[model samples]
Target: MRITRIETFLVPPRWLFVRIETDNGIVGWGEPVVEGRSETVRTAVEQLAELLLGKDPLRIEDHWQVMTKGSFYRGGPILASAVSGLDQALWDIAGKHLGVPVHQLLGGHVRDRIRMYGWVGGDEPAEIADSICAQLDVGLTAVKMNASGRMHPIGSVGEIDGVVERVAAARDVLGPHRDVAVDFHGRFTLANARRVAPLLEPLRPFFIEEPVVPENSHLIGQLTRSTSIPVATGERLYSRQEFLPVLQAGIAVAQPDLSHAGGITEVRKIASLAEIFDVQLAPHCPLGPLALAACLQVGFATPNYLIQEQSIGIHYNQGAEVLDYVLDKTPLKFVNGHIERLTGPGLGIEIDEQAVRSADKNGHAWRSPLWRHDDGSYAEW
Candidate 1:
């Protein structure tokens, strides 16, 4: 069927949703946002719609190649995220048209269920234990927390101790059976990460995420070698080419965000590339339901898949939540820390069109938080 209409919705709590409608009465939805820069990515999506309007909806690869290479000045968060959402919509359409799930089209399921992890706010160490316990109350066996908020470039003894204390608190609550992953969140410099990673090694964290920002990925190998903790990154890295260096840098887990890293089309290839390095796939998804569903589709089909990062009760969802826009929450629910295979077509979860339209009426202007050190200089948040 030919794509007849394309629409984007700026929903609450910082999310951008795109809907693609085909002439034969089928509609597919995708989330294409760059967290705080939804409007810019929305504009990019509108522009990319020009390439897909009146074209075959199932030609996902051709559309991907053109949307990515169609512009000479290509490949950044804005463009990659734009292509990501549209790519998700195209794959959704393909699955619906073929009457199968997206993972089936990708070569069927590799596992019956996918493991998932939830977020627990660790910016404040006081709440780390309580937040992790709250996640456990909801049946999540694993949880991820930030290493620190607005950490000093060269952390003091206190800052390093605080990071350890926070993780220790989480580990105390989770005990030995459950898992805890620490997120550096691009807030640490290479030196600080190197110093702090070793301390967390005693706790045996599931992984240390984004030990350094994407720009400093060249130094990640050193961090990985110095510590026994598994290193995971790629939430900021946007393509297979961009991920190649980090994969070669000796990461043990690759955390590509389906919403940011060229959607399923490119992330599947990224997973394959990481497989050659003997790394595990743990798709980073802290957005909305569509993004999570897309990640699950890939996770169920990918052989090296480790775990999935979802934002169900994440602190980011202020005015909305992951299940708010879905018609059926069954497909998205977690069972014993794992999400059972999704059987529905496309992304599997049917979005509430009415709820989405209503939410878009009062769209949000969410922006990332700005942080500064005690001396009033800039700091990562």
Candidate 2:
């Protein structure tokens, strides 16, 4: 079927959804957003649509190559995220046309159920033990928390002790069975990242995320060698070429976001590349329903898929929750901390068009906070 039209909606709580309409009455949904830059990504998707209209929606790979390389400049948050949403829609259409799930087309599923993790702490963490307990009460066996908030390049031992205390509290609440992962959120410099990386080992975190930013790969290599805990990053990385250096640098887990990393077409390629290096997949998805659905499609098909991130009750989505705009919220239910395989065609979940249209006008221009130190120095948030 030929793609007839592309539509976008800036939905509530900072999400942008794209819907691609085809001639055969089959439509596909995608979430193409960069957390705070929803409008910019929407414009990028609109420009990319110039190349996709009237093209056969089923030629996913050809379209992907063209959408990516057709432009002289490509592969950043805006361009890749735009391509990512459109690619998800194309794959969704392809799966529906064949009357099979996306994973079935991608060599079928390797596992019956995929494990999922939830977020506990917000940008600035507080009541972490209570948050951990809340997630555990909801049947999540694993939860992730930000390691610290607005840390200085060189901080005091008291600052270091606070991070240690947060993880330690989460560990105590989760006990030995449940896993806890700490995210440094790329706020720490190489020196602090190296010094604090191994300290979390005693707490037995599942993995430490973005110990240092992607720019500091050499430091990551050093930190990985110093600690036994698995080092996971790549949420900010936009392409496979960007992922190669970090993979070669020796990360134990690759956390590509389906909404940002060129969607199913490129993330599948990224997953394959990571497999070659014995790396695991823990897709970074903290967006709305469409993004989570896209990640599940890839997670189900990928062999090395470790755990999927979900924003079911994340802090940022205060008024608009993940299930609000979804027509079939059942696919997101967790059973003993794992999501059972999706059996429906395409992304295996339906979108509530009525709700989407209604919420479109209520969309917020959501932006993350910029923090400053006590002395008015800029701090990472």
Candidate 3:
């Protein structure tokens, strides 16, 4: 069947969803957002759709290469994210046509279910112990939180002590068995990363995310040598070529987002490349249902897969949540901190098209916050 229509929706809580329609009446859903820049990605998808109309819906790889490389200049958050959403929809269509889940198309599942983790304590840390305890009470085995609210290029020891205290509180609540990861959120500098890294070492975190930024690969090697904790990054990275240095640098985990990092087609390759270096896969997904579903499909197929990051009750979602626009949330059923393998065809979860159409009318224009320090200088938020 041929692709007939491409539609996009900018919904609440800073999300953009894409739907691909085919002549045979089978449709597929995808999330191709760049967090705050939903509208820009939407326009990118619309422009790409001009070339995609009347093409074979099942030619996912060809379409992927064309949609991405078909342009002379390509691969960044906006263009790649637009291509990412389209790639997801193409895979979803192909899976439905074959009467199997996307994982099956990727060579089937290696395990039963993939463990998932959720965010707590918002962007900063406060009442985090209660949040940890609440998730633990719900039978979640893993949770991740931000390490600090904001910071300077060189932070004070008192600031480091505050982070240590927060982690200590989480460790106390988590006891010794559960896994806890901290996202530095690229707020820490190499100097600060070194200082904070060793302090959190005794707590034995599951990992420390973006100890610095991906731009600081050399510094990552430096920090990892100083600390025993596993170093995880790559949420902002867009390609396998970009990830080679991260893997070669001895990064413990690769956290590529299926939605942002070229969707299923490219992330599977990224997972394979990471596996060769003995790096684990812990997809970074803090968006909506389609993005989470896409990550799950990859998680099931990748052998070195670790826990998946989800945004079920994340601080980013103010009004609309993951289960908001879906018809059946059962496919995403989280139990005992893990979501079972999706059995349904395509991305496994069906969207409420009517709900989507309605939400599209409300059509949001969401952007992330821009933070600044007391000196009126910019600080990562």
Candidate 4:
């Protein structure tokens, strides 16, 4: 069957969903968004649709190669994210056509269930304990929290102490059996990260995510070597090529977002490359249902897969949630901190087209928060 129509929806709480239709009536859905820049990515998706219409829906690899390199200028968040959603849709179609799950087509299950982690707002140390406890109540054994909010460029002793205090709070709540991952969120300099990572060592965090932003990746090896904490990054990174240097920098975990890093097609390759380095795949997905579904497909087939990030009750969701647009939440239900392998074809979870269409009419314009230091200088948020 040939692809007949490609439609994009600008949904609430900052998500862009793409729906691909084929002549024979099978439809596949994907989340192709760059979070705050969903509109720009939506335009990119519409432009990419030009190449997909009237083509064979099953020519995934060929379409991927062409969509990525078809343009004179290539490879950025918008283009890669655009290709990412379309790629997911193609894979979904292929899986449905073959009457198997996407992971089965990828090779098959490496494990029966996938471990998942939820987000806890750690910007304020006082709220961390309660937030983590809430996640625990919902059966999540692990949770990720931001290490700091607006950190000083060269963190003061107080700022450093606050970071330790926040993690200590999470550790106190988690106890020894549960896990806590600290997200540096690229808010720290190399020196700041180096200074603080060792302090968190005693708490034994599952990992310190994005210790330094993607731009300063060259310096990550320094931070990784100086501290015993496992370093994880790649949410901002968009391809295997972009991830190679960071992987070479000795990160212990690769957190590529399936929605941003060329979807399942390229992230699977990134996981393979990271495997050679003995790194684990903890896909960075704090988005919507389709993105989480796509990540799960990859996690099931990948041997080195560690944990999955899902945005069920994340603070980012203002007017909508992960389960809001899905018809059946059974495939996404958490059982003792893990989601059982999805058995349905394609992405496994069926999306609510009516809900999605209704939400699009009142689309959101979400932007990342901008921060400034006490002295009025720009700061990472």
Candidate 5:
């Protein structure tokens, strides 16, 4: 069957969803968002759709290569994310056509259910402890939290103490068996990363995410060698080439977002590359149902998979929830801190077309907030 139509929706709480239709009536959904820049990615997908119309829906690899590299200027967040959503849809169609899940198409499942982790939010010690307990009540075995709210570039001793205290609080709630990971969100500098990574070492966090930004990945080896705590990154690294250096540098985990890092086609390759270095795959998914579904497909097939991150009750969701437009929440139901493998074909979840069409009419213009340092210098958001 040939691809017939490609439609995009900018829904509430900062999300962009893409729907691909084929002549034989099978359709696939994808999340091709760059977090805040939904409209720009939408335009990029629209431009790419011109070349995709009337093409074979099953030519996934060929379509991926052409959509990503066919353009003169290619492979940034916008183009990569646009290509990512389409790639997901293409894979979904292929899986449905073959009457198997996407993981089976990748190869086959290496294990049963993959372990998942949730996010808990709060600043104060009591609040943070309460949030962790709340997640545990829902059967999550592990939880992640921001190391600190807003950080100074060269932070004071008080800031450093606050980071340690928050982690200690989380560890206290998690006890010895449960896990907690801290997301630095690329706010820490190399020196600060060195200081904090070691301090959190005693607490034994599952991992420290984005100790430094992807741009400063050259410093990763130094940071990794310095801290006993496992260093996890790559949420911002979009290509296999980008992941190579850090992998060689001894990063403990690779957290590529399926939606931003060239979708299933490229992330599988990145996972293979990371596997050679003995690194684990903990996909960075903090978006919608389709993105989480895509991450699950990869996790099920990949042998080096560690844990999965979903956006179920993440603070980012405002008016809409993660399962808001999903017709069947059974596929994503979390139990005992793990989501069972999806048995349905394609991305393995059904999208509510009516809800999507309705949300699209009142589409959102969502953007991440900009933060500034006390000196008025720009800070990473």
Candidate 6:
């Protein structure tokens, strides 16, 4: 069916949702946001709509190649995120039209249930213990926490010890049974990453995320060689080309965001590329329902899939939660630390259209927290 109209809704708690409608009255939904840059991504999606209007929604592959490469200046977070949401909507429409799930179209299910992890707030030892306990109460077997917040570029030895102590506290609470993943958040420099890696190795964190920013990805190989802990990154990477260097860096896990990294179309290919290196695929999804649904679709079909990240009670969801705008929470209900395979057609979850449209009326302009050191030098958050 021909695409009739494409609509975008800027929802609260920093999210942008895209809806694609066809001549046959079938509609598909997707989440296309870059955390704080929802309005910018929405504008990018609006511009990309010119290329997709009146085109057949079923031609997913062709449209993907064009939307991603047609523009000479392409493949940034904004452009790729716009294409990501559109590609998700197209896949959602394709699955619904065929009366099957996206994973079924991708190949068949490899696992009956996909393991998921929750994000715990980065606070003091007591607060960290409380948050980890809370997540465990809800049946989460694995939880991730930020190692440190607003770290200095060259932190002192005491600060390094504090960072390790924070993680060690979580390990103590988890009791060597449940998994604990530590997020470096790209705040640590190469030297800091190296210094902390050996200390954290003793605790055996699930993985160290973004030890440094993507710009310093060449150093990832050195860091990976130094530490036995797995290295995972790529929420900012936008395409297969961007992922090639990181995979070649000997990283053990590749974390591509379904909403940021060209959606299912490119992420599925990214998973294949990582598979060649024997790396695991753990999607970085901390957004709305449609994005998580799209991530699960890929996780179900991908062979090297490791785990999925969902923002159910993540600190980012202030006024809005994951299930608030979703009509079918059954597809997302966590049980025994894993989400059972969704049998519904199209991304396997239904979006509440009325809630979305109403939220868009008073859309939000959310921005990431900007931090600074004591001397006013800028610091990563």
- lDDT comparing candidate 1 with the true structure: 0.93
User: Regarding TM-score, does 2 or 6 come out ahead?
Assistant: 6
lDDT, candidate 5, 134-160, per-residue tens: 889988999999888778878889999
lDDT of 4 by residue, 59-104 (tens): 8999999999998999999999999999999999999999899999
- In terms of lDDT, the best-performing candidate is 4
Superior by TM-score: candidate 3 or candidate 6: 6
> Each candidate: what lDDT?
0.93, 0.90, 0.88, 0.94, 0.91, 0.93
The residue-by-residue lDDT of candidate 1 on 169-198, one tens digit each, is 999999999999999999999999999988
Model 2: residues >4 Å from true position, as ranges? Answer: 122-126
**TM agreement with the true structure for every prediction:** 0.99, 0.98, 0.98, 0.99, 0.99, 0.99
Tens digits of per-residue lDDT for model 3, 248-312: 98899999888889999999999999999999999999989999999999888889999999888
Superposed Cα deviation of residue 348, candidate 6 (Å): 0.4
User: Per-residue alpha-carbon lDDT of model 2 for 307-370, expressed as tens digits?
Assistant: 9999888889887999998787788899999999999999999999999999887777899898
The segments of candidate 5 whose C-alpha lies over 4 angstroms from its true place after superposition are none
Residue 3 error for model 4, in Å?
A: 0.4
Of candidate 1, the 10-residue stretch with the lowest lDDT total is 121-130
- Is 2 or 4 the stronger prediction by TM-score? 4
Question: Could you tell me the lDDT of residue 224 within candidate 1?
Answer: 85
Candidate 6 least-lDDT 10 residues: 120-129
| Model 5, C-alpha of 217: deviation from truth (Å) | 1.1
State the lDDT at 169 in candidate 3: 81
Residue 93, model 5, lDDT: 91
lDDT for residue 27 in candidate 3, whole number 0-100: 93
Root-mean-square deviation of candidate 2: 1.3
